[model samples]
Target: MSGHSKWHNIQKTKGAADAKRSAAFTKIAKEIIVAVKQGGSGDPANNSRLATVIAKAKAANMPNDNIKRTIDKALGAGNTDNYESVTYEGYGPCGVAVIVEALTDNRQRTAPEIRHYFDKFGKGMGAQGCVSWSFDRKGVIVISNEDEELDEDTVMMDALDSGAEDFSADGPVFEITTDPDAFNDVVAALEKKGYTFESAELEMVPQNYVTMTGEDDVKNMEKLLDMLDDNEDVQNVWHNWQQD
Candidate 1:
């Protein structure tokens, strides 16, 4: 299975509330608010970032009403939640490279809390560019295989024609990769062709993966990931751990 699909399935199997769906909603809402503020528009047509966040919200199963409300609130007068983007790079257990992306109003608290996780469960935190140099940012789109009418050949051809950089069919989904600049155009083209995605987002793709064989190392790595994911300030966690 592809790495993206493996992580996706693992998340799905973690069950609903235990997986912290509510926290997921909050994270996506923060993303919408930030996108609106940065892009200076609520309409997706004018704001490409907002459009991307909207797609992510939909993929997370966030309700349309909730999304609209958040956007409206974000555009309202006197909104004070000005979140700044922060990224932290570190090494998880067994030398696995991990990157965390967060949007926070309080960097002082967020930074310390994140560093604590690394200190407690990893090989200690690193400088800003330490582990990030090993990763490349890419646009990933996932389409489910549940649709009987969906043709793999047709989808692959359409994806490439739509400006996708690469395409793969692994397990239950089709993974389409695109250059970051061409992401929106590719997504728009796929949408016009009536393709609904399981998920779509920009992610850091690791060039090399770490293999963890020690039981203690694997346990600590899981703990580290859980701590990061459960944090309210954290938006996304990217790692290079190769799951067996």
Candidate 2:
């Protein structure tokens, strides 16, 4: 979870930079478009994926108009271009493993571009299952435990009751995981209990982590991961690089 926290920090720093705001919006919009398509409905109330993405976009202070426009495009019958969700697995500099989840209208165009980025960074993409075996699909939800609103034990008990598989502390928040089908119920239960979180979304958790001992190696690895994250087709990037 520390590695995930560090990665989130890096993304936050990059997103805050003035030069990256446009890029951030593009990425967020793409996610909304894809989420609407995947969820099969434009209304967030009926579409869990769209609801989660809307929450994330709202957190970033993205304009409501922009969000509505994107959703309308997704629902519009005139739209023809179709995007497919794909995951790419690979190892980064210093041998850190990575998984890149993308939503692209053209895999033919996206695959080559993604491969090139890795090749240029002295890292190479792996076959379908090469690095995927290291990760397990899980529902990850982040919730605030501030104001002593929910003690750890109380939260843990409720989470387990709601079908959560595991729980951990990620910085000042709790990271809860559950079976994919149980995600909605777990989150709803937590919310009903008055826990307000910064963010909640599904994620891939690595079964094992590759630790970097040398500072130089860690720096290089970070640069490579950052480059992978900037791709337009990419939605989320996951890795197993423990960070303190």
Superposed Cα deviation of residue 35, candidate 1 (Å) = 0.7
Candidate 1's C-alpha runs over 4 A off are: 1-18, 146-149
**Residue 99 deviation, candidate 1, in Å?**
0.5
Report the error of model 2 at residue 222, Å: 0.8
lDDT of 2 by residue, 188-231 (tens): 77777776555566677788777778877777676666776667
Backbone clash tally (model 1): 0
Model 1: lDDT to the true structure: 0.86
Worst 10 residues of 2 by lDDT: 1-10
Model 1 over residues 69-112: C-alpha lDDT tens digits? 99999999978889999999899988899999999999999999
Question: How does each model score on lDDT?
Answer: 0.86, 0.73
TM-scores of the candidates are: 0.92, 0.80
